[model samples]
Target: MVELDSRVETRDGVALVELVVRNPTDTARRFRVGNLLDGPLWPPRSRGVPEAGWDDGGFEGVVPAEERRALGYASPLSGGARSDSLPEPPAEIVWTERAGETEAGNDASFAAEATPEGVVRSLGDHRPPADAVPTPRSGDTVSTPESGRSEPDPRRSP
Candidate 1:
């Protein structure tokens, strides 16, 4: 099951909203926290690409299994105006599913693999360390300061 708790506060001419979404089930759940109040939603951060939940008339993100995630947004009040009525059940659940169970699950190549580390690491992360010096490959001419000469790298078998 999913649980939602929301609080709204008006401060400095803006209405600040804080929401806590909880997932108490064994499966992870996806939810949408709608903007039931007046004005456009401004996520926690405004710069760069827009956050996950702001574009769809609300905030949308995943709450992991047996875990909760906090989401918040702010809306500017018009001339310090106030609303006498508030929306009931400020947030609603869109859907929930087992973690990593996607439509692509039917494909063997796209299946998700759980690791002992409890985190998925990308396959393209094999690049050398950021600070590591570039090594000359086979057939590349390298200049050596010790010998003061240019020659094929000794590290490679000719």
Candidate 2:
């Protein structure tokens, strides 16, 4: 069986997420992990809002090819004989944020057992600087304060 774990953290307005895929089987197996974007949560409509799938943010690297073969998969990249595409398991997993938001979608599913044995980090912080202007490096552009003609105190800027 495959197991996938996802961890999310937010810092400075950015969200950091980490995904760990593990193969518990004695043999190796190939697998794919995709991020689900937007979908409805399980139980339907009671949650009052839709959820975001894995693709909504970021994803970890592809599962190793050798591992796929060990799992008896005809082709690691392909979902196998179950269908022209990979099979979709029941909606057994659900992730919710502290803000009462939920994420769900078809692509949200991943080989949990194929995930690595670590935490998943996602970064979502995008706050602008408090008062300082950004300067370009190695270019002929000069960085002046909002005054457009004078340089401001560097200490006051971020």
Candidate 3:
């Protein structure tokens, strides 16, 4: 399982509600993020985590072991809505193990060990600048390039 935390910032004009997931698993596996039941809807331009379910409403992706990943969606500001209402992402998250993957029974606990300010500052260093293009580390899909988007994996991305 991965521990998660939420943070929001206005990049340009979009209200980017970002979630940082801490993967403590030893092997690479995919994780799922439930929908924002209380906050604004996720926009199309919003990147980071992969969409899950047949309808692509939720998020699914691979997080490398002992690494931090920023996965989130963005929403354009609405006239009637206030950005203050944005919900802080939950600290608890679940990492779904595939059929062949080992299941580390949820015997351990996940906690937000770092300060919020420290986490925010660290995220800035992981991602690349807006104008940069990502280079592929795997065959087809392009992972997060210079940005702290995603950690590198020798195997295919889920």
Candidate 4:
């Protein structure tokens, strides 16, 4: 079984989220995920971030060949562009599988929390610093591909 845990922290008004992906397999694998938090509590509507499935990297996340990677910084939650309903943490994740040694998409077990001030209330202006931008991998210029979702195991409790 795989484990998926999500942590949400509000710093300087920006919602910083970290998704931890763990694979129990002997070898490392790749996983794709998006809308990891797209559900009722975290409605598609946003006052902070672009729609989960929008231009924001498709399924918008990738768990690298490492056994465990915290995927954040790349996707930060924003207070809705027009409203105060800040975005909630993604509640789910789907890892990708290639043909050869690829592993099937395992359901990510999920968990979430917010700072006292970041508890799904109204938000303030908290854009990232212009210099905090992420660097591309070596010479890769394109964004990571959007991921397809698979049947998440029964543990969907948030």
Summarize candidate 4's per-residue lDDT along 38-61 as a digit string, tens digits: 221232334454333233433433
Q: Please say which candidate is ahead in lDDT: 1 or 4.
A: 1
Over 4 Å off, model 2: 37-158
The prediction achieving the highest lDDT against the true structure is: 1
Using lDDT, rank the candidates from best to worst: 1, 3, 4, 2
Give the residue spans of candidate 4 off by over 4 A.
Answer: 36-55, 58-66, 74-91, 98-158
Order of models, best TM-score first: 1, 3, 4, 2
**lDDT-superior candidate, 3 or 4:** 3
The collision pairs in model 1 are 53-59, 53-60
Q: lDDT tens string, model 1, 62-134?
A: 6777888887778776664774344544445555555554422121121343432112132224444545756
Best candidate according to TM-score: 1
Task: Report lDDT per candidate.
Answer: 0.61, 0.31, 0.52, 0.44
Query: What residue runs in model 1 are displaced by over 4 Å at the alpha carbon?
Result: 83-90, 94-158
- The local distance difference test score of model 1 is 0.61
User: How close is every model to the real structure, measured as TM-score?
Assistant: 0.54, 0.27, 0.44, 0.37
Name the 10 consecutive residues with the lowest summed lDDT in model 2.
69-78
Rate residue 17 of model 3 by lDDT. 63
